[model samples]
Target: MKKLVVLLSLTVILSACSAQASTNKDSNKDDKEKVSQSSEKKQTSSDVYVPNPQLTDDRSLLEIGQAFKDDKGVSSLKAIKKVNETYRIGDVELIIHDVKVIEHTPSYSMIDYFHGFTHEETFDFVKANIEIKNTSDQPVYFSPIAILESSTGEHRDWEADIYLEELNGELAANGSKKGNVGFILDHSDKEVEWVKIFTSDLLNEEQKVTNKAQEITIEF
Candidate 1:
């Protein structure tokens, strides 16, 4: 009888150990799934493109007009330079420090419910890091209005998003500011040859496109 009781006790101990091992395996599986879900959420958040509120409400942007009129580019872009090279537009000195092309995988798009703008179309963006300096004695206003010209002669305009902050206001005499602007274009397999960043005086609302307008072209 003592031997039988000892055997039964051992059986119970073995069963308890087996159960604990099974529970541990299930817990590990749950932990792995949780980690995977967390990683997916982080990836999804990074893919979304949000717009800037201050620039979004600006009515002046609508007045800028379409990129191509009569199948011809309206903006008279000046010379094109590679990244890190400086170009001049009137008295303002501008440089495109870097250029990056961003692609949204899984083809995500959005409908801005509040603003009533539909960004549902799948598109890619070419972002340019720019630096603007006022070389003249007078204060000049800098408009973040520009276009991205592809090697194939395609022209994409400056898209107003959170990354393209407000460079619309005035810059003091000899003052400088740095920021990024993005151009919206179709998801292209081709590479961009150059980028054109144009600036106009906000103070002169009547003459939207005039001789005072200046442009800086950045080649890839």
Candidate 2:
């Protein structure tokens, strides 16, 4: 009878030990899941892009230009990754997808045709495929007169734009637009190494024009 009682006690002890082991395994799994979820949240937060408030504040063209200079200017096309990266210039976010240099591009109008036929007034164009995004709370206007500042300090604006209807327009809060813009340059046999792209509110002449415009720069 005593042996039977001892046998029963051992069975009960084993059952209790088994239940505790199962509980520990389940608790360990829950801990691992919680840790994994926390890591994912951190990754998502790090991936989000936010513009610098100091750079995004309403500022003048010259002030924005100075800020650009201070930040060591913008990134060049070669430096940009294939993943659509947003760059903050003043209050504007700019992405230059591609830049193409076309030789002997025809001028914008019949006047160009008349001039070309009469005095050979043809020119070359540097076409750019760009995307601009406004991150500010207020609406911002973009100018088609994006200037190309050469390494030698020569600044030239677009002569003809056929990629988009109007280069100048208003972009609402959190708005984005993509289009092609072209710049006219003197026909040259030499290749351009790099040029900086500048968009300014100072280029606008309307009554609602604000001195709070910014000059955003992108290098290509």
**Cα lDDT computed for each candidate against the true fold:** 0.42, 0.40
Cα lDDT tens digits for candidate 1, 37-98? 44321122113223333122111112212121221112211222226656666666666555
Candidate 2, residues 163-199: lDDT per residue as tens digits?
Answer: 3323345544454444556554453444555666555
The residue ranges of model 1 lying beyond 4 angstroms of the native Cα positions read 1-82, 105-122, 152-154, 158-162, 199-211, 214-216
- Which 10-residue window of candidate 1 scores lowest in summed lDDT? 68-77
Query: Model 2 segments beyond 4 Å from truth?
Result: 1-85, 105-122, 151-154, 158-164, 201-220
Per-model TM-score versus the true fold: 0.46, 0.44
- Indicate which candidate wins on lDDT: 1
Worst lDDT 10-window in candidate 2: 55-64
Residue 83 accuracy (lDDT) in model 1: 66
Residue 23 in candidate 1, Cα distance off native in Å: 63
